[model samples]
Every structure is written in structure tokens, then in C-alpha cells.
Target: MLGLSAFLESGRGDKLSSPVKQFIQNLLKANMEGPYGSEWPAEEKVKRREMVAPEARYVFVRIASLGEFLTTSEREKTAASCVEERGPIVGFVHFRFVIEEELPVLYVYELQLEPRVQGKGLGKFLMQLIELIACKNHMGAVVLTVQKANSAAMNFYLYKMRYVTSTISPSRVDPLIGIEKSYEILCKTFSNEAKAILEEPLELVHSV
Candidate 1:
């Protein structure tokens, strides 16, 4: 289990361990820094908090351990359905949010798939599910950061659901590795649709 140690290890519990945290830390750093420079301690800590808050309603996908899965985290369980094929847990999606603008900005915090189930359209399905949750929550919009280099994922965010691009600053700790290293932000809005729907509601109801 050379590469699978983190995924296979027991006692993962609710929060990510230091090593797991470090792995995510470095992964995000590389993604942000373009395999070039390093991040400072303060910057690293801020990144870690943003990614793996223990209180955040994180999601995990697994193939086994159905009975006791919900008890393994600090956050409250929202949706915990299984994806079965021929009958077993093949994948799952976890979602949560941080408050923004007095509304919950839905975050598709974690998505995972077993190697055996990777190629199917499950990812797209899960994303749509998250989007519906965002709509239901009446969020100002949904936000998630993706590496600029990941074209496949960027396409999914951009074309599939119509996420618009924006940018954020590069803190001193993790200086922008290059132009592409700027944080990529995406959002969706409902104000236009809301105005249209609200205006027609009384007229439509009366006509009906």
C-alpha cells in the first residue's frame, strides 16, 4: 500500500491527521506554486484551516463500513446515501458550507471514487446534486477553488454547470508561482432568475 497508506489507514476518525494535513498542504501548495517555490508557515496554516476544518461537514466515499460511517466525524450528517453496484458502496459525496453574505455558500468540499469506479459519470452526478443543494440553501453563490492546470476539472466546472471565473490574491507565504498560480474562483448566481420568477408568480397564479 505504498501510495494508498493515507486512504487505507485506520483511525482517520473525524479530522485529518498531521501527515494527511501535510499531504493536502503540499498538494495545494504545488497546485498553487507550480512546482516551484515553497510556502511559509503562516500561509500554510491558513491554507490548512480553509481545506480541512474538523467542524466542516466533510464527505468521504468508501466501499465498506456502512454501519458505522456516520459516527466518524465532528460535523453533523446531512446526506449519507450510498452508491451501490451489483450491491456495495462504490462512491459517495460529502458537502458543507461556510457562511458568506448572510447566506451559506455551498462548498462541494470532498468528492471521492474508488479506482474501480473512477471512469463513470458519477462525478458529474454528484456535482449536480451539490448544485441543487446550493439552490435549496438560497446561497448567494457556490464557491470552490481548483488548480488552473487541471483542464479536465476546469472544463467540468466551466462548461457543465456554467461556473464563472474570478481570482484572488497570492499571500506572501505562497507567492504566485506564475500567472496561472492566482487562485481560481467560480460562482453561480440566481438574482436574475429570481426577479423573473417573482414577477410572474402573481400573474400566473391568477391566470391559472
Candidate 2:
């Protein structure tokens, strides 16, 4: 296995590592099949690559604002970028920076992975990196939105990353029909050691 430090170091250029770029492309291709029962246009995938860098390889989600309602954007200026391991570009995340309760927070704007790497635990690895981001920035937690039906993602956050399920709601894109829920808010430190005790992995006991 590659060390996290080595994987983190692999990120450069567009904040994407070589491994991450390949992952994002695969994700786009697989999901390019589109939504429930609908066909995702192939040309659209081409357009997505054009919008984001062709070689992007990391997955960092962000938030943004446009018109009256909030929206998602990926173009980076001075804030953050996601880089993977293989090279400089493959997959990437788009996000907006904001404050919550007077603490710096990242509102996961958007995320994507390469098709070939979706089920190989990349998401979990990326999320742990977010914890480092929170600690480095002196923030309380990282927040993101997931569609209610994305059960696989829900399990990753609730189980692997130790995030709590908060509330269930709908999204703007067909908000009335489908629901979007927020999950996984990590506190600066464990609020309750007892809870932490039960949650802590046996292997990590030595680290503590």
C-alpha cells in the first residue's frame, strides 16, 4: 500500500495525482450512463472533460453561489484542488469555501472519480484527508450532500469515516421529487470520549 504521505505528495499541478485522474475519468464514464433509466449522452462526457482539466486526478468537493440560489463550481483560483497518485490529472473536485458558526468550513461543492476506481476505497482515503484539512484549518467539520438513494456513499461516511447522519431533505435539481440528505460532520475533537471509546478502532489505540 502507498503511504498517505506519499499519496498526498503525489498531488501537484491541478491538485490531482496520477491515480486520481484515472479514477475520475472512469467514474465519469460509468456514470455517463446517466440517471435512473435514462441514457447519459456520450458527448456530454466529452464536455465534462473540457470543463474540468483533462488530466485532473484528485477529488475535492466545494460549494459556490450564483444568482439567488446556491450552486456548484470547480474552477480554482486560490482555495483548494484535489490531486491523485498516478500523475498530475485524472479526477477532481469543485468546491466553495464558507463559514459556519464562525468557523472555517468546506461545503462539498461537487465530486467525481475515475470509472475504473470507484469501489476500490479511494473515497474513504480522500475523506480521511478531509479530516487533516479540518485539523490544519482549525475547523469544526466537513459537510456534504448526497442523494438519498446513494446507499453505497451513505455507508462509506456513516461507517468507515465515522460521520453521523443528521437530516433528510431534497435537492434543487428536482427537489420536489427526490431527497438530499446531509451527513458526516466531524467535531474538532471527540465530543465524548466514551462515544469515542466505542467508536475507536483497536488498532488505533496504540496511536492514541
Please give the CA lDDT of all the candidate structures: 0.48, 0.43
**Candidate 1 — worst ten consecutive residues by lDDT sum?**
1-10
- Write down the TM-score for model 2: 0.46
Off by over 4 Å in 1: 1-54, 62-94, 101-103, 167-182, 193-208
- Top TM-score prediction, candidate number: 1
Error of 2 at 149 (Å): 2.3
Candidate 2, lDDT over the whole model: 0.43
C-alpha lDDT (0 to 100) for residue 167 of candidate 1:
26
Per-prediction tally of clashes: 1, 38
What does candidate 1's lDDT look like per residue over 117-163, in tens digits? 44455566667767777788786556676555666667877897677
